[model samples]
Target: MRNIRFLVVIYLICQNTLFAQNNPFYNQWEPSPKEGAFQMEDYIVWGGSVIKGEDGLYYMFASRWPKHLGMSAWVTNSEIVLAVADKPEGPFSFKKVVLPARGKQYWDGMMTHNPNIHYHDGKYILFYIGLNYEFDQPEKVGATRELYEEAWNHKRIGVAVADSPFGPWKRMDAPILQPRPGKWDGAIISNPAPVIHEDGSVLLIYKSAPVPYPARNQNRTMNFGVATASHYWGPYERKGEDNQIKLLPISSDVEDPYIWYDGSKYHMLAKCMNEAITGESGAGFLASSEDGLVWKTSENPIAYSRNITFSNGEKVNLPKLERPQVLIQNGQPSHVYFACRNPEGQIFNMVRPLRRNQ
Candidate 1:
């Protein structure tokens, strides 16, 4: 019996090694460019989603808020903005603010963030998280926790439709998805990652919480769910058991997910909130789902680490690297975009090219 157990252990190790070797996304990262980053002198940038337009240009919808307002103010002051680049690996220049604070009266009036752009059925769909609160906007870095908590609970997934990327966008009066009052997603819905199908259906994944803000501080956890809509803009219905996609049986601590359907199967890459499955905090993990509802971790699950390599061969583990977005060209992933913060508090959007012909 002891020998049999030892054989089982050896089989498991061999399986892991074989899977790692066969994983397409593993070791596919090429050293990134040193200069072509999207940044602003007075703002903190995050969550960049790029799409190639019919005009033969790349358009990026990203989130940014004033630097003086502090990082926590992202819940209150962030806005969705547009940038343009000639190439996917971009030195993208800021074009304009696409979604800004209008008023607290509107559902998404206060702030817009985490833009995920898609082009489908002759229209451009911009998916994001927005929030509103009754209080006045905070001025400086140190704001009250109450103010932050209130803003956090207000987050909801929203979308804006436009004929062209250049826009006269028609934003909805109500959000596309909202929190369930007593359900697992009772607190809020944020960080939308959507894949618009060729048949005009949409499979969206978003971050959710069980309890409202401040209450969840004692046990901070997040859950991810998949919702489907027949049309791009629609009454989306949650799928799976209890409307939650439990990626890991042990922990539901993943966040900032980016999902895509690459012809055959659905793929997801998300930030590992804890070292539960990936064994490294802040690493990106890959998961696969035959259908959008049921998902399992990819064989070599560690998609990326915080450590980044430059074309010049310098490697640095970023202090903060979150919000993974992929730019797919001709049904192939060409580059991956990330929101990174260095130790000096400098925040920017970085793009790393993916090795092709895999």
Candidate 2:
């Protein structure tokens, strides 16, 4: 009996070691340009997405803000910008500011952030969050608190459409999806991860909450919800109306979710708010569901961790890695992108290529 138990322990250890050796191609991001290739002069660039356009160049949609605005400026003054690179691992050149503030009347006119670019139905669709402040204060650093709160209280999901990635984008007059009055997502909807299906349908997985909404994320909790539309310019309807928000229950509050349906199942890589639920603070959760509404996290749901081992043999456990996005090139997940600050005090996006067997 003792020998049998020893053999069982040995078998488990060997299996674990073998699994650890099989790192995917995109797991280790290239640390060649230590400062990262996406930084701007007076702006701190974040929230990156890379897409191959008809021009054969990779167009990246990302968020940026003034350097003096501090890290917290993302909420109040962030704007979406476009950059072009010859390759996905880009020495990218700035193209233009894709989405900027219009005015106070439009729902997303005050600020434009969190750009998720996709080519859908023979057009380029840019989905994002916009906020407006009707308050009596100027929107600066400290004085912008009331404005920030109003923006937070009024944030909604808006979309822009264009023929080319380098667009003269035609933005819709109103948000496609808005907060429901008495539903779980009544407060706000942000952080949109949308997948346009081969059948021409759209599936958007976004973060939301109810009306007793707190301004800060760490002070409150968020859940992932699904909405479907036959057309990108839709009539999007939430999957389970009352139970729309709380898919995983309060025991496992998730955020920063990037979801895709890979034909057979829905796959998600989201941040687990509680360390006990997913191993570490920034340890990502790998979950799946056959139907989009029902989800199940993996038995050992550690997708990746903050402690990254770069391709060039540099390894550092950063403070945290936020915003997980996958660049699908040639019909497969070719690279992974995330927002992280380097040791050089520059916050920019990072990428790691995903290969079959590294």
Candidate 3:
């Protein structure tokens, strides 16, 4: 009887694994670059956050801008818009704008981008980066040179709460995470992706850049950083304030950090501009951490668009296909999404598959 019971348990485990592999959306994603995948002829979609709502639908919150303005215009001009699809690999239909320009009443009153959505305590929290007037105006642009400098001095990370994923979200009156004095992130606090541990503490992974010495805009290098809070609506404290947020065991020029816990360990996928590898553009690099604070990049890049192409004739070779985001269904990773930019540098979110066997 004991031998039979042990065999039954082993058979059940194999069956469960087979069922998970059979899931269509599981390990079945591909770049949904159908002709006219983007609804607007002139606007490109980028910096999106995806969530599976209670209504059994997938919703994406992304930044959109007029194609004529180009990707560089995202800083000063882009707005956050909503798109929805019946499935994860979407022929997603454009929905209404979530956050429009605030018209100078508040700091992020000009542009809202980098939407990161997660559900906590029966509420959905939308964390994002907002550009204030200090960073948006052309006259003040010289005050800060690098992306991190501008983000620290001008941008702020804020959160909004709603009962449902499709929210009439109530935003916190003040920013949740801001720059501090003499800290690695003291220069800027943006790219708000949060990971909730089993113990209920929230670990928010973000990007920060130190102010360049010579004050050259292009010299600035963005790196991944972390902050922690006892509660979700946090006055999040940087992990190593006294020691400084350690750069994720990789060289500089990494950003758009997305982190998750894969059963036993924490994993991260980020976009890095490593000139040595691709010559000009960069690729997506994978990293892992035993604890959330320390990170080491894998010797090999997990994915590179330069080696792949989409159906819509978008060559992944260019400096495009950054901002990697993954989709989890029932606690297992199923899909990896990337922001595929065009020749003019306009960004559109694209999907791809993730399976070891594949």
Candidate 4:
């Protein structure tokens, strides 16, 4: 009996060692902006998403505002632009604006922001937010102020399509998801990122605010939720409520969700107001789920900024780092690209390569 017990103890020790090696967040922290990469531009560039296409280049979709306007301009006056790089770690060159301000005759007729892009079924779909202002008089600029006040009460998540990564894209005539009247997502539905399953179903993860509450000028809470569709273009339904759309259980005041699978389990990285393990802003938290619907978060943040500025001379360690997009090489996360805000608290597009081995 004593000999048998000794063998069991040895086997258990080996099993625990193997398990520890597989957890990606086992290490405390890792270095970013790997050697020899150009730092990001100092200007405000938020809402970044990256894609490596068959053309053998990296394409990034980001929200940009002029330097003179400051960060708040994104709420009133910002446009989505595309940037291209020969490699994931830039020197990236500005391409062109993807979504211009709406013309006339649409709800999102004024400002456009919060871009997330994903390729599905041989096409690229871009999701973003559109704010509409209803002017009392078309001729008077001052009257437009009251119009915006009423419209600013809500925002919608809109979708657009492109045949190629770099393209003259086509926008959907209407939004895929909108705010519900008295629910968790009633106030607003923005920041959309689509997840495509192997079985050909699509899941959309987005941020929302409560309705019948305070105005944009007032303080409000933003939460995340998921919606599903049998096809990429639907009539998509929420996970619960008899296809009536339901919200996810976890509540962390989190935004900008990026999801991925590692063959064994699904993982997510999101931006939160809560202090991370390092107790700093711009720190990202990691979570895992055996099934995609439920999630388990780590006690500490898995990723944080090291106070290294980008090439554009912008301070790297600001409180605002939203939109976490993962680069999967060989089926694992090799790098993460985020929307980094400047020292003054404006958003900018930046990329940080992860040390997977660590």
Give TM-scores for every candidate, taking all chains together and pairing residue i with residue i: 0.91, 0.85, 0.78, 0.78
lDDT of 4 by residue, 1-358 (tens): 9989999999998865564344343342344443222223544667567778778888877777655555445655667788888887765677788887766477666667877777777888777787665542232223334444455564677777899867777876777777776777777777776776766577777777776344545647777777877766667766643222222333456677777777677677777665533355546666776655676764543554436554445445555566777777777666667666456554455676655553
Kindly give the number of clashing pairs for every candidate. 0, 4, 3, 5
Pairs that collide in candidate 2 are 25-353, 25-355, 26-353, 26-354
Show model 3 residue runs off by greater than 4 Å: 1-32, 36-39, 134-153, 181-183, 198-200, 212-218, 241-249, 275-281, 299-301, 311-316, 344-346, 355-358
Best-fitting candidate, measured by TM-score? 1
Q: Between which residue pairs do clashes occur in model 3?
A: 42-67, 152-187, 152-188
Candidate 4's clash total is 5
Instruction: List the global CA lDDT of all models.
Output: 0.85, 0.73, 0.66, 0.64
Write down the RMSD of all candidates, one decimal each: 4.7, 4.1, 6.9, 5.5
Model 2, runs deviating above 4 Å: 1-33, 135-140, 212-219, 245-251, 343-345, 356-358
Give a tens-digit lDDT track for model 3, residues 1-358.
9999999999998875674443322223354454323346667677567788888998878778666755565666667778888987776788888877876777677778888877766787788888666444332222333543444356678877789655687776677766664545556677877887666578888876665233436547666677788877777877754434454444567777788886677777676677542233566655667777777754443444445556675544555666667777777666666667556554567766555343
Question: Candidate 2: lDDT over CA atoms?
Answer: 0.73
Question: What is the model-wide C-alpha lDDT for candidate 1?
Answer: 0.85
lDDT of 1 by residue, 289-355 (tens): 8887777885357788888898999888888889999888887677889998866667889988888
Judge candidate 3 at residue 170 and give its lDDT.
76
